[model samples]
Target: MVTPELNGGDVGVGVGGGSFDFQRYLSARADAVNDALDRAMPRGFPERLCESMRYSVLAGGKRVRPVLALAACELVGGDAAAATPVACAVEMIHTMSLIHDDMPCMDDDALRRGRPSNHVAFGEFTALLAGDALHALAFEHVARGCGDHGVPADRTLRAVAELGSASGTGGVAAGQVADKESEGLPVSLAMLEYIHVHKTARLLEAAAVSGAIVGGGADAEVERVRRYARCVGLLFQVVDDVLDMTSTSEQLGKTAGKDVEADKATYPKLLGVDKAREYAADLLAMAEAELDGFDAERAAPLRHLARFIAYRQH
Candidate 1:
């Protein structure tokens, strides 16, 4: 569904036309991202291993990270198509994290994106290996694609480092550790932010920052995009928590209410749904603020994206 602002009567951060066709935009971008991902990975020798990797990577997702990367690139006036390899790299890393996150040792979720979790379908050992392989491939693909596309070596190197940092501690790994520790324990709002910022926000921030860098944005522009992504990243998790509280498995395409069932802390569990929605609204405003100076037409997608995160019913 279209977000509140993009739909019409946009309470704040006015983009009042209600004509962006966001769903169409998302479908087109997702299709291109999926196709690029398909070409980026080929079935190779060690048949089962390749199969495991393909299983998770090909499994459908919202493609948020890759889209963020490409959009940030375009926002900086870079040819979004040239950013394809970096986009694919970000998605590969995200798939890697999901593989590990759903294992028996982690969230142990049986359903992901409407199918059996990777470990359930592929076996833990293979799933584990697949995660490792994808992680490695993310860096390799970034490096290879950067060289082929004639991106400046320095920029390419920075993007590579950025992805590594996002996947490592201080990013996804650190967030996962905090989340696991907080399970079944009382969690403060600050601690929750720490967890989500590190786990979810970090990778998303990296996605936009790296995209901006490779897209040839100035340092100031890249930093601004980072701030915008930080809000969107947290907004994503906040919305997820709300969805778990209100939506069904049929709507979400995955197991619903997993957070509460696990006794894990969530925004709704702490702040209640109304307050959580308020927080999401604040975040949406902040994200939109960061795009203020860019051309409205070029910036419309990012604006629509933030609203989508805020108002998405499904």
Candidate 2:
């Protein structure tokens, strides 16, 4: 496990000094993730199910998770190209979570990324199957792509282990369960933290650590990346809360105000919109501090990314 001290270094402030173009990095990495998905997916499946998965997975988002993975790899002196597979894997897993989260049995979201959600577009059964398929495909893609790149078997295995651990009971799944239970119930701040940390932060941490592991980061740097991910992960949730109350469904491309409607516990609900925004900023600063030892240039995308998360309307 990554230590808390490593996670809590100097807080990052100001725009990153790195030359990395956030737009270019996001676009290029998203394209690579798409290409990897195309290459890794089966050529023939139930065509309809395939289409359903494609529809949602290919939907536009910032692809922030994959970008983080790639950046962490590069900062560790690892080849970005070699990390592409894992980056794609992170996206696949993220997509899978979205599919499941949108289920009627889950969040019951009707839209995603500015379009009808997978369950709404495709049937609930198909959406469920697609989510399952994507979950399996994530591991398959990572293992095959990493093997093709000659990543050591042990490291590749470690990446898989990390992904599973973060997405399972100790991580994302637990958060989901907590989220479901917390609705309509008065939840304490600690409970809210538990949900966000496990549900959102775990996978974000996994994405960063997976990239570092596959890219061959030293243990120390891997720990630092994990810390960075945690700060950003919590910030991501806080901004999400702020956006839900402030952004339109059209702007967010998802069901907005669902948290309030469902009486789900959210930072904004607890702290109000302005305070939630302030909290997000604080988390971003901490994340930046975690990356201070690296050249400012190397961590620019991450710094801007945190800011983007804090202020994003959608």
Candidate 3:
């Protein structure tokens, strides 16, 4: 769905307008992600490892993280093209996490986004290497992408720092550890908060913040976008928990009901499906509200993106 501004000249097709297809935006974003992926690959990386990275990285999911980054960059008047490398890097990191998370030692699922898990398709050792390779490559892409941008050296350094903290031990890694320990146990809300905030929200916050930095958003704007991102990040997970309870495997492209199977604590389990859905809606609303002072035209995509996160069945 396209988010119409409260008031403005919307020169193009938007959600309900003449020819503005939301799918067009999705297509453009997907193409951008793929192009960035091609640019970010290492020249001499092993052909086999490159093939596996490509296998998952190009596996054709929604490209949500990259979209979020691009949307944030656009909202701040940055060239979406300039943000492509960082977008692709963040997505690579995300995909790598998924690969490792699905290993027998981790979430142990046989399916992902609707196909055999990476570990299932490649041997566990190869999958392990692929995941590790992608992780290192993510940082490499960030450094290279930032360097190519001609951004001020200081700004580039800040961007790299933000990305590092978000994906490193204090962020996604910490969340992963918490998730591993929570299985089959009745998790406290505090622990669940740790998992969602660090594991899920951290990367999202990084995406938005990086977008602003690359776009040269003023300090205030960067902070605002980060706040918006935090709300949406948690909202994303809430919707995920809700979908896990209600969506079918065909819709989700992965094993549904596996949360129950694994006894993983989720919002639906902790707060009930109805309440979780409501919470997701509220968080999205908060995210939109945070953008109230932004240039409405520029922020339209981000607003729509926030709503899309909550409503997306997949």
The regions of model 3 sitting more than 4 angstroms off are: 1-21, 42-45
TM-score of each: 0.94, 0.92, 0.91
Query: How many clashes in each candidate?
Result: 0, 5, 2
Q: Judged by TM-score relative to the true structure, which candidate is superior, 1 or 2?
A: 1
Error of 2 at 223 (Å): 0.4
List the candidates ranked by lDDT, beginning with the highest: 1, 2, 3
Candidate 2 C-alpha lDDT tens digits along 31-87: 886777676666566898888878877786877788788878887878887778888
Poorest 10 consecutive residues of model 3 by lDDT?
A: 1-10
Candidate 1 lDDT tens digits, 260-279: 99999999899988888888
lDDT, candidates in the order shown: 0.85, 0.81, 0.81
Q: Give per-residue CA lDDT, model 3, range 1-314, as digits (tens).
A: 21212111232345222354455676788787887787676555677677778888888887878888888888888888767777887888898889998999988989997889888888898899999999888877777667677666677678778888988886898899999898988899889988998999889889888878888889999999999999989988887887788878998999998887888999989988777777776897789898998877777777777776766757
Tell me how far the alpha carbon of residue 18 in candidate 1 is from the true structure, in angstroms, after superposition.
9.0
Candidate 2 stretches with Cα past 4 Å from truth are 1-19
